[model samples]
Target: MSRIVLITGGQRSGKSEQAEALALSLSAHPVYMATAHVWDDEFRKRVEKHQQRRGAQWTNIEEERWLSRHDMTGRVVLVDCITLWLTNFLTDGQTTEQILQDAKDEFDRLTAQDATFIFVTNEIGSGGVSENALQRRFTDLQGWMNQYVASRADEVILMVSGIAVKIK
Candidate 1:
Protein backbone atom coordinates (compact mmCIF):
# COMPACT_ATOMS: atom_id res chain seq x y z
CA MET A 1 0.00 0.00 0.00
CA SER A 2 1.01 3.62 -0.54
CA ARG A 3 1.11 6.46 1.99
CA ILE A 4 0.59 10.12 1.11
CA VAL A 5 1.57 13.17 3.16
CA LEU A 6 0.55 16.66 2.11
CA ILE A 7 2.36 19.71 3.50
CA THR A 8 0.95 23.10 2.62
CA GLY A 9 1.59 26.70 3.68
CA GLY A 10 1.92 30.27 2.53
CA GLN A 11 5.08 31.50 0.78
CA ARG A 12 8.26 31.02 2.87
CA SER A 13 6.29 29.10 5.48
CA GLY A 14 8.78 26.22 5.65
CA LYS A 15 6.63 23.71 3.81
CA SER A 16 9.64 22.26 1.98
CA GLU A 17 11.65 21.99 5.17
CA GLN A 18 8.91 20.06 6.90
CA ALA A 19 8.48 17.77 3.94
CA GLU A 20 12.25 17.13 3.79
CA ALA A 21 12.40 16.31 7.48
CA LEU A 22 9.45 13.95 7.19
CA ALA A 23 10.97 12.25 4.17
CA LEU A 24 14.34 11.82 5.89
CA SER A 25 12.62 10.34 8.91
CA LEU A 26 10.82 7.81 6.72
CA SER A 27 13.82 6.78 4.61
CA ALA A 28 17.58 7.10 4.74
CA HIS A 29 17.88 7.92 1.04
CA PRO A 30 14.59 9.43 -0.01
CA VAL A 31 13.81 10.55 -3.54
CA TYR A 32 13.68 14.32 -3.92
CA MET A 33 11.40 14.85 -6.88
CA ALA A 34 11.49 18.52 -7.87
CA THR A 35 8.76 19.75 -10.17
CA ALA A 36 10.31 23.14 -10.85
CA HIS A 37 11.11 24.32 -14.39
CA VAL A 38 13.96 26.84 -14.39
CA TRP A 39 12.94 29.62 -16.75
CA ASP A 40 15.78 32.05 -15.98
CA ASP A 41 19.04 32.56 -14.12
CA GLU A 42 17.37 33.77 -10.94
CA PHE A 43 15.08 30.78 -10.83
CA ARG A 44 18.02 28.51 -11.53
CA LYS A 45 19.86 30.03 -8.58
CA ARG A 46 16.85 29.42 -6.36
CA VAL A 47 16.82 25.82 -7.43
CA GLU A 48 20.50 25.59 -6.62
CA LYS A 49 19.86 26.91 -3.13
CA HIS A 50 17.37 24.12 -2.55
CA GLN A 51 19.84 21.59 -3.90
CA GLN A 52 22.52 22.86 -1.56
CA ARG A 53 20.30 22.37 1.46
CA ARG A 54 19.92 18.63 0.94
CA GLY A 55 22.76 16.28 1.80
CA ALA A 56 24.26 13.56 -0.42
CA GLN A 57 21.74 11.05 0.94
CA TRP A 58 18.99 12.27 -1.37
CA THR A 59 18.28 11.00 -4.86
CA ASN A 60 17.16 14.00 -6.87
CA ILE A 61 14.85 13.81 -9.89
CA GLU A 62 13.80 16.90 -11.82
CA GLU A 63 10.55 16.41 -13.69
CA GLU A 64 8.46 19.41 -14.67
CA ARG A 65 5.46 17.23 -15.51
CA TRP A 66 4.44 13.62 -16.11
CA LEU A 67 5.34 12.42 -12.64
CA SER A 68 3.44 9.19 -13.21
CA ARG A 69 6.16 8.07 -15.64
CA HIS A 70 8.54 7.56 -12.73
CA ASP A 71 8.17 4.27 -10.90
CA MET A 72 8.77 5.03 -7.23
CA THR A 73 7.48 1.75 -5.80
CA GLY A 74 8.62 1.04 -2.22
CA ARG A 75 10.50 4.35 -2.00
CA VAL A 76 9.95 7.58 -0.15
CA VAL A 77 9.46 10.39 -2.70
CA LEU A 78 9.19 14.06 -1.73
CA VAL A 79 7.65 16.27 -4.41
CA ASP A 80 8.80 19.80 -3.57
CA CYS A 81 5.85 21.90 -4.66
CA ILE A 82 2.56 21.57 -6.49
CA THR A 83 2.45 25.27 -7.51
CA LEU A 84 5.28 24.94 -10.00
CA TRP A 85 4.02 21.62 -11.25
CA LEU A 86 0.63 23.16 -11.87
CA THR A 87 2.24 26.16 -13.57
CA ASN A 88 3.92 23.86 -16.06
CA PHE A 89 0.55 22.50 -17.09
CA LEU A 90 -1.15 25.91 -17.11
CA THR A 91 0.90 26.95 -20.13
CA ASP A 92 -0.12 23.96 -22.21
CA GLY A 93 -2.99 25.96 -23.84
CA GLN A 94 -5.63 23.87 -22.15
CA THR A 95 -8.60 25.23 -20.28
CA THR A 96 -8.33 25.42 -16.50
CA GLU A 97 -10.83 22.60 -16.07
CA GLN A 98 -8.94 20.39 -18.51
CA ILE A 99 -5.65 21.07 -16.83
CA LEU A 100 -7.12 20.40 -13.39
CA GLN A 101 -8.59 17.06 -14.49
CA ASP A 102 -5.28 16.08 -16.08
CA ALA A 103 -3.39 17.01 -12.94
CA LYS A 104 -5.73 14.99 -10.75
CA ASP A 105 -5.45 12.02 -13.10
CA GLU A 106 -1.66 12.22 -13.10
CA PHE A 107 -1.65 12.44 -9.32
CA ASP A 108 -3.84 9.37 -9.08
CA ARG A 109 -1.55 7.36 -11.33
CA LEU A 110 1.57 8.42 -9.45
CA THR A 111 0.15 7.60 -6.03
CA ALA A 112 -1.08 4.18 -7.13
CA GLN A 113 2.44 2.81 -6.63
CA ASP A 114 3.34 1.27 -3.30
CA ALA A 115 5.48 4.11 -1.97
CA THR A 116 5.48 6.98 0.49
CA PHE A 117 4.74 10.37 -1.06
CA ILE A 118 5.44 13.66 0.73
CA PHE A 119 3.98 16.55 -1.24
CA VAL A 120 4.92 20.19 -0.57
CA THR A 121 2.52 22.89 -1.73
CA ASN A 122 1.79 26.57 -1.20
CA GLU A 123 -1.48 27.88 0.27
CA ILE A 124 -1.71 30.98 -1.89
CA GLY A 125 -5.42 31.56 -1.71
CA SER A 126 -5.57 32.16 2.02
CA GLY A 127 -4.71 35.81 1.63
CA GLY A 128 -6.58 38.56 -0.13
CA VAL A 129 -7.97 37.90 -3.55
CA SER A 130 -5.64 38.61 -6.46
CA GLU A 131 -6.22 41.70 -8.56
CA ASN A 132 -5.02 40.09 -11.76
CA ALA A 133 -7.26 37.71 -13.61
CA LEU A 134 -4.49 35.28 -14.41
CA GLN A 135 -3.37 35.23 -10.80
CA ARG A 136 -6.92 34.56 -9.71
CA ARG A 137 -7.26 31.71 -12.15
CA PHE A 138 -3.97 30.19 -11.10
CA THR A 139 -4.90 30.58 -7.44
CA ASP A 140 -8.13 28.73 -8.02
CA LEU A 141 -6.35 25.92 -9.82
CA GLN A 142 -3.72 25.64 -7.15
CA GLY A 143 -6.30 25.64 -4.37
CA TRP A 144 -8.29 22.91 -6.05
CA MET A 145 -5.19 20.82 -6.67
CA ASN A 146 -4.11 21.23 -3.05
CA GLN A 147 -7.50 20.15 -1.82
CA TYR A 148 -7.47 17.13 -4.08
CA VAL A 149 -4.04 16.05 -2.90
CA ALA A 150 -4.91 16.69 0.73
CA SER A 151 -8.05 14.61 0.42
CA ARG A 152 -6.01 11.62 -0.69
CA ALA A 153 -3.18 12.20 1.75
CA ASP A 154 -2.94 10.01 4.78
CA GLU A 155 -1.60 13.00 6.71
CA VAL A 156 -1.87 16.73 6.11
CA ILE A 157 0.28 19.39 7.76
CA LEU A 158 -0.24 23.10 7.62
CA MET A 159 2.93 25.12 8.12
CA VAL A 160 2.56 28.47 9.79
CA SER A 161 5.53 30.67 10.71
CA GLY A 162 7.88 27.73 10.29
CA ILE A 163 5.75 25.63 12.63
CA ALA A 164 3.92 22.52 11.51
CA VAL A 165 0.31 21.96 12.57
CA LYS A 166 -1.15 18.60 11.74
CA ILE A 167 -4.63 18.87 10.26
CA LYS A 168 -5.16 15.24 9.37
Candidate 2:
Protein backbone atom coordinates (compact mmCIF):
# COMPACT_ATOMS: atom_id res chain seq x y z
CA MET A 1 0.00 0.00 0.00
CA SER A 2 1.09 3.54 -0.64
CA ARG A 3 2.12 5.50 2.46
CA ILE A 4 0.38 8.65 3.59
CA VAL A 5 2.27 10.66 6.19
CA LEU A 6 0.95 13.55 8.23
CA ILE A 7 3.40 15.94 9.90
CA THR A 8 2.00 18.39 12.44
CA GLY A 9 3.63 20.93 14.75
CA GLY A 10 3.56 24.53 15.93
CA GLN A 11 4.54 27.38 13.64
CA ARG A 12 8.22 27.52 12.71
CA SER A 13 8.63 24.03 14.13
CA GLY A 14 10.35 22.80 10.96
CA LYS A 15 7.41 20.67 9.90
CA SER A 16 7.79 21.73 6.28
CA GLU A 17 11.49 20.94 6.29
CA GLN A 18 10.84 17.55 7.77
CA ALA A 19 8.07 16.86 5.27
CA GLU A 20 10.37 17.78 2.41
CA ALA A 21 13.07 15.52 3.81
CA LEU A 22 10.65 12.63 3.97
CA ALA A 23 9.48 13.31 0.42
CA LEU A 24 13.09 13.30 -0.74
CA SER A 25 13.54 9.83 0.65
CA LEU A 26 10.80 8.59 -1.64
CA SER A 27 11.87 7.05 -4.96
CA ALA A 28 9.71 9.41 -7.04
CA HIS A 29 10.07 13.09 -7.76
CA PRO A 30 8.45 15.33 -5.18
CA VAL A 31 5.45 17.49 -6.09
CA TYR A 32 5.02 20.43 -3.70
CA MET A 33 1.48 21.57 -3.08
CA ALA A 34 1.86 25.12 -1.81
CA THR A 35 -1.32 26.50 -0.32
CA ALA A 36 -0.07 29.89 0.71
CA HIS A 37 -1.28 32.93 -1.20
CA VAL A 38 1.11 35.75 -1.83
CA TRP A 39 -1.18 38.53 -0.71
CA ASP A 40 1.47 41.02 0.31
CA ASP A 41 5.12 41.80 0.01
CA GLU A 42 6.00 40.04 3.25
CA PHE A 43 4.03 36.96 2.29
CA ARG A 44 5.59 36.95 -1.18
CA LYS A 45 9.04 37.18 0.36
CA ARG A 46 8.25 34.36 2.73
CA VAL A 47 6.97 32.25 -0.14
CA GLU A 48 10.10 33.01 -2.08
CA LYS A 49 12.22 31.92 0.84
CA HIS A 50 10.34 28.67 1.06
CA GLN A 51 10.69 28.15 -2.68
CA GLN A 52 14.40 28.84 -2.50
CA ARG A 53 14.78 26.36 0.29
CA ARG A 54 12.97 23.69 -1.68
CA GLY A 55 15.13 24.46 -4.76
CA ALA A 56 14.41 23.73 -8.39
CA GLN A 57 13.88 20.00 -8.15
CA TRP A 58 10.42 20.19 -6.63
CA THR A 59 7.43 20.51 -8.96
CA ASN A 60 5.55 23.35 -7.26
CA ILE A 61 1.79 23.54 -7.55
CA GLU A 62 -0.05 26.54 -6.13
CA GLU A 63 -3.29 25.45 -4.56
CA GLU A 64 -4.95 28.19 -2.58
CA ARG A 65 -8.32 27.36 -1.04
CA TRP A 66 -10.05 24.05 -1.54
CA LEU A 67 -7.83 21.86 -3.62
CA SER A 68 -9.86 19.99 -6.23
CA ARG A 69 -10.05 16.22 -5.94
CA HIS A 70 -8.08 15.81 -9.16
CA ASP A 71 -5.00 17.80 -8.15
CA MET A 72 -2.86 15.32 -6.20
CA THR A 73 -1.00 13.00 -8.58
CA GLY A 74 2.70 12.17 -8.83
CA ARG A 75 5.28 9.86 -7.36
CA VAL A 76 5.27 11.88 -4.12
CA VAL A 77 3.19 14.91 -3.21
CA LEU A 78 3.98 17.11 -0.19
CA VAL A 79 1.36 19.58 0.92
CA ASP A 80 3.49 22.23 2.61
CA CYS A 81 0.88 23.17 5.21
CA ILE A 82 -2.89 22.99 5.76
CA THR A 83 -3.43 25.80 8.27
CA LEU A 84 -3.46 28.57 5.68
CA TRP A 85 -5.59 26.46 3.41
CA LEU A 86 -8.18 26.00 6.16
CA THR A 87 -8.16 29.68 6.95
CA ASN A 88 -8.71 30.49 3.31
CA PHE A 89 -11.64 28.13 3.11
CA LEU A 90 -13.16 29.60 6.27
CA THR A 91 -12.70 33.19 5.13
CA ASP A 92 -14.25 32.32 1.78
CA GLY A 93 -17.51 31.63 3.65
CA GLN A 94 -17.60 27.89 3.22
CA THR A 95 -19.84 26.12 5.71
CA THR A 96 -18.13 23.83 8.20
CA GLU A 97 -19.74 20.77 6.69
CA GLN A 98 -18.77 21.82 3.21
CA ILE A 99 -15.19 22.40 4.30
CA LEU A 100 -15.02 19.00 5.92
CA GLN A 101 -16.52 17.33 2.89
CA ASP A 102 -14.11 19.06 0.58
CA ALA A 103 -11.19 18.01 2.74
CA LYS A 104 -12.38 14.43 2.77
CA ASP A 105 -12.76 14.43 -0.98
CA GLU A 106 -9.26 15.76 -1.43
CA PHE A 107 -7.90 13.20 1.00
CA ASP A 108 -9.62 10.41 -0.85
CA ARG A 109 -8.21 11.64 -4.11
CA LEU A 110 -4.70 11.69 -2.69
CA THR A 111 -5.05 8.20 -1.26
CA ALA A 112 -6.45 6.77 -4.46
CA GLN A 113 -3.55 8.08 -6.50
CA ASP A 114 -0.53 5.89 -7.07
CA ALA A 115 1.85 8.07 -5.07
CA THR A 116 3.30 8.68 -1.63
CA PHE A 117 1.81 11.67 0.21
CA ILE A 118 3.17 13.87 2.97
CA PHE A 119 0.82 16.38 4.56
CA VAL A 120 2.15 19.19 6.72
CA THR A 121 -0.14 20.94 9.20
CA ASN A 122 0.06 23.19 12.22
CA GLU A 123 -0.81 22.06 15.75
CA ILE A 124 -3.10 24.94 16.65
CA GLY A 125 -4.98 23.51 19.63
CA SER A 126 -2.14 23.74 22.15
CA GLY A 127 -2.37 27.54 22.28
CA GLY A 128 -4.51 29.28 24.87
CA VAL A 129 -8.20 29.61 24.19
CA SER A 130 -9.14 32.38 21.80
CA GLU A 131 -11.15 35.36 23.02
CA ASN A 132 -13.23 35.75 19.86
CA ALA A 133 -15.84 33.40 18.56
CA LEU A 134 -14.36 33.19 15.06
CA GLN A 135 -10.91 32.51 16.44
CA ARG A 136 -12.29 29.82 18.70
CA ARG A 137 -14.14 28.23 15.80
CA PHE A 138 -11.02 28.29 13.68
CA THR A 139 -9.00 26.66 16.42
CA ASP A 140 -11.61 23.96 16.88
CA LEU A 141 -11.81 23.30 13.16
CA GLN A 142 -8.04 23.12 12.87
CA GLY A 143 -7.90 20.52 15.62
CA TRP A 144 -10.68 18.55 13.98
CA MET A 145 -9.02 18.69 10.59
CA ASN A 146 -5.73 17.47 12.01
CA GLN A 147 -7.44 14.63 13.79
CA TYR A 148 -9.27 13.57 10.64
CA VAL A 149 -6.13 13.59 8.52
CA ALA A 150 -4.02 11.82 11.11
CA SER A 151 -6.63 9.13 11.47
CA ARG A 152 -6.35 8.30 7.79
CA ALA A 153 -2.61 8.70 7.49
CA ASP A 154 -0.26 5.71 7.62
CA GLU A 155 2.27 7.67 9.70
CA VAL A 156 1.72 10.66 11.95
CA ILE A 157 4.63 12.72 13.24
CA LEU A 158 4.63 15.63 15.66
CA MET A 159 7.62 17.90 15.34
CA VAL A 160 9.06 19.87 18.24
CA SER A 161 12.26 21.86 18.03
CA GLY A 162 13.08 20.20 14.70
CA ILE A 163 12.70 16.73 16.23
CA ALA A 164 10.03 14.34 14.97
CA VAL A 165 8.04 12.18 17.37
CA LYS A 166 6.00 9.44 15.78
CA ILE A 167 2.52 9.53 17.27
CA LYS A 168 0.97 6.71 15.24
Candidate 3:
Protein backbone atom coordinates (compact mmCIF):
# COMPACT_ATOMS: atom_id res chain seq x y z
CA MET A 1 0.00 0.00 0.00
CA SER A 2 1.07 3.56 -0.64
CA ARG A 3 1.62 6.08 2.12
CA ILE A 4 -0.18 9.40 1.95
CA VAL A 5 0.70 12.21 4.34
CA LEU A 6 -0.94 15.60 4.77
CA ILE A 7 0.91 18.41 6.50
CA THR A 8 -0.67 21.76 7.31
CA GLY A 9 0.12 24.91 9.28
CA GLY A 10 0.16 28.70 9.14
CA GLN A 11 2.28 30.59 6.66
CA ARG A 12 5.99 30.38 7.49
CA SER A 13 5.07 27.71 9.99
CA GLY A 14 7.53 25.17 8.52
CA LYS A 15 4.89 23.03 6.84
CA SER A 16 6.72 22.94 3.54
CA GLU A 17 10.02 22.21 5.19
CA GLN A 18 8.51 19.43 7.20
CA ALA A 19 6.85 17.99 4.15
CA GLU A 20 10.15 17.98 2.31
CA ALA A 21 11.88 16.32 5.23
CA LEU A 22 9.21 13.66 5.38
CA ALA A 23 9.48 13.01 1.68
CA LEU A 24 13.23 12.81 1.89
CA SER A 25 13.03 10.37 4.73
CA LEU A 26 10.77 8.15 2.66
CA SER A 27 12.94 8.07 -0.46
CA ALA A 28 16.34 9.36 -1.50
CA HIS A 29 15.18 10.77 -4.85
CA PRO A 30 11.94 12.53 -4.07
CA VAL A 31 9.99 14.61 -6.54
CA TYR A 32 9.12 18.10 -5.31
CA MET A 33 5.92 19.33 -6.90
CA ALA A 34 6.09 23.09 -6.49
CA THR A 35 2.69 24.68 -7.04
CA ALA A 36 3.69 28.31 -6.68
CA HIS A 37 3.76 30.61 -9.69
CA VAL A 38 6.39 33.29 -9.78
CA TRP A 39 4.15 36.19 -10.73
CA ASP A 40 6.53 38.85 -9.44
CA ASP A 41 10.01 39.42 -8.11
CA GLU A 42 9.05 38.69 -4.51
CA PHE A 43 7.43 35.40 -5.39
CA ARG A 44 10.41 34.49 -7.53
CA LYS A 45 12.77 35.19 -4.67
CA ARG A 46 10.69 33.09 -2.34
CA VAL A 47 10.74 30.23 -4.81
CA GLU A 48 14.50 30.57 -5.14
CA LYS A 49 14.93 30.47 -1.41
CA HIS A 50 12.90 27.27 -1.22
CA GLN A 51 14.96 25.80 -3.99
CA GLN A 52 18.15 26.66 -2.18
CA ARG A 53 16.87 25.01 0.94
CA ARG A 54 15.98 21.84 -0.90
CA GLY A 55 19.43 21.78 -2.48
CA ALA A 56 20.28 19.54 -5.47
CA GLN A 57 18.87 16.31 -4.07
CA TRP A 58 15.27 17.07 -4.96
CA THR A 59 13.89 16.80 -8.46
CA ASN A 60 11.72 19.92 -8.82
CA ILE A 61 8.55 19.98 -10.90
CA GLU A 62 7.26 23.52 -11.33
CA GLU A 63 3.57 23.07 -11.92
CA GLU A 64 1.42 26.20 -11.79
CA ARG A 65 -1.83 24.58 -12.92
CA TRP A 66 -3.56 21.31 -13.90
CA LEU A 67 -2.10 19.21 -11.09
CA SER A 68 -4.64 16.47 -11.44
CA ARG A 69 -2.91 14.76 -14.33
CA HIS A 70 0.72 14.91 -13.33
CA ASP A 71 2.60 11.61 -13.37
CA MET A 72 4.40 10.73 -10.14
CA THR A 73 6.57 7.71 -10.62
CA GLY A 74 9.75 6.10 -9.25
CA ARG A 75 10.32 8.72 -6.55
CA VAL A 76 8.30 9.88 -3.59
CA VAL A 77 6.21 12.93 -4.54
CA LEU A 78 5.85 15.97 -2.31
CA VAL A 79 3.21 18.49 -3.23
CA ASP A 80 4.49 21.68 -1.64
CA CYS A 81 0.99 23.04 -1.36
CA ILE A 82 -2.62 22.51 -2.37
CA THR A 83 -4.03 25.93 -1.42
CA LEU A 84 -1.99 27.92 -3.93
CA TRP A 85 -2.78 25.38 -6.61
CA LEU A 86 -6.48 25.64 -5.74
CA THR A 87 -6.28 29.42 -5.70
CA ASN A 88 -4.69 29.42 -9.13
CA PHE A 89 -7.47 27.23 -10.43
CA LEU A 90 -10.13 29.48 -8.90
CA THR A 91 -8.54 32.68 -10.17
CA ASP A 92 -8.51 31.16 -13.65
CA GLY A 93 -12.33 30.84 -13.52
CA GLN A 94 -12.65 27.37 -12.04
CA THR A 95 -15.46 26.99 -9.53
CA THR A 96 -14.99 25.76 -5.99
CA GLU A 97 -16.65 22.47 -6.78
CA GLN A 98 -14.39 21.98 -9.75
CA ILE A 99 -11.33 22.75 -7.69
CA LEU A 100 -12.35 20.26 -5.01
CA GLN A 101 -13.11 17.61 -7.56
CA ASP A 102 -9.80 18.06 -9.28
CA ALA A 103 -7.91 17.98 -6.02
CA LYS A 104 -9.69 14.83 -4.91
CA ASP A 105 -9.08 13.15 -8.22
CA GLU A 106 -5.41 14.02 -8.11
CA PHE A 107 -5.07 12.82 -4.56
CA ASP A 108 -6.68 9.53 -5.44
CA ARG A 109 -4.52 9.09 -8.46
CA LEU A 110 -1.34 9.83 -6.55
CA THR A 111 -2.26 7.51 -3.74
CA ALA A 112 -2.80 4.72 -6.24
CA GLN A 113 0.68 5.18 -7.61
CA ASP A 114 3.69 3.18 -6.46
CA ALA A 115 5.40 5.96 -4.53
CA THR A 116 4.71 7.79 -1.30
CA PHE A 117 2.88 11.12 -1.46
CA ILE A 118 3.19 14.03 0.95
CA PHE A 119 0.82 17.00 0.61
CA VAL A 120 1.39 20.38 2.18
CA THR A 121 -1.39 22.87 2.84
CA ASN A 122 -2.01 25.94 4.95
CA GLU A 123 -4.33 26.01 7.95
CA ILE A 124 -6.27 28.97 6.65
CA GLY A 125 -9.41 28.86 8.79
CA SER A 126 -7.53 29.12 12.06
CA GLY A 127 -6.95 32.81 11.43
CA GLY A 128 -9.52 35.48 12.12
CA VAL A 129 -12.46 35.98 9.82
CA SER A 130 -11.69 37.53 6.48
CA GLU A 131 -13.13 40.94 5.69
CA ASN A 132 -13.96 40.21 2.04
CA ALA A 133 -16.02 37.69 0.14
CA LEU A 134 -13.12 36.33 -1.92
CA GLN A 135 -10.92 35.91 1.11
CA ARG A 136 -13.66 34.13 2.98
CA ARG A 137 -14.43 31.90 0.06
CA PHE A 138 -10.79 30.95 -0.37
CA THR A 139 -10.40 30.20 3.32
CA ASP A 140 -13.48 28.04 3.42
CA LEU A 141 -12.48 26.16 0.31
CA GLN A 142 -8.97 25.58 1.59
CA GLY A 143 -10.22 24.37 4.95
CA TRP A 144 -12.52 21.91 3.25
CA MET A 145 -9.77 20.74 0.99
CA ASN A 146 -7.43 20.21 3.93
CA GLN A 147 -10.06 18.17 5.74
CA TYR A 148 -10.78 16.08 2.68
CA VAL A 149 -7.13 15.31 2.09
CA ALA A 150 -6.49 14.60 5.73
CA SER A 151 -9.28 12.06 5.78
CA ARG A 152 -7.50 10.03 3.13
CA ALA A 153 -3.99 10.51 4.43
CA ASP A 154 -2.28 7.75 6.35
CA GLU A 155 -0.60 10.43 8.48
CA VAL A 156 -1.65 14.01 9.16
CA ILE A 157 0.70 16.53 10.77
CA LEU A 158 0.27 20.07 11.96
CA MET A 159 3.51 22.03 12.07
CA VAL A 160 4.38 25.14 14.08
CA SER A 161 7.68 26.93 14.48
CA GLY A 162 9.48 24.17 12.59
CA ILE A 163 8.08 21.55 14.91
CA ALA A 164 5.77 18.78 13.70
CA VAL A 165 2.78 17.54 15.62
CA LYS A 166 0.95 14.54 14.30
CA ILE A 167 -2.82 14.98 14.31
CA LYS A 168 -3.73 11.67 12.73
Candidate of highest TM-score: 1
Better of 1 and 2 by TM-score: 1
Residue pairs in candidate 1 whose N, alpha carbon or C atoms collide under 3 angstroms: none
lDDT of every predicted structure (CA atoms): 0.95, 0.82, 0.83
TM-scores for all predictions: 0.98, 0.90, 0.92
RMSD of each: 0.7, 1.8, 1.5
Q: By the lDDT metric, which is better: model 2 or model 3?
A: 3
Q: Write the per-residue lDDT of candidate 2 for residues 28-98, one digit (tens) a residue.
A: 46888888867799889988888889866788888875454544555688887778877777766877778
Q: How big is the positional error of residue 66 in model 3, measured in Å on the Cα after superposition?
A: 2.8
* Clash totals for all candidate models: 0, 0, 0
List residue ranges in candidate 3 displaced over 4 A.
none
Stretches > 4 Å off in candidate 2? 66-74
* lDDT per residue (tens digit) for residues 70-136 in model 3: 6775568998888888777776677778877877786677677766789899998997998998889
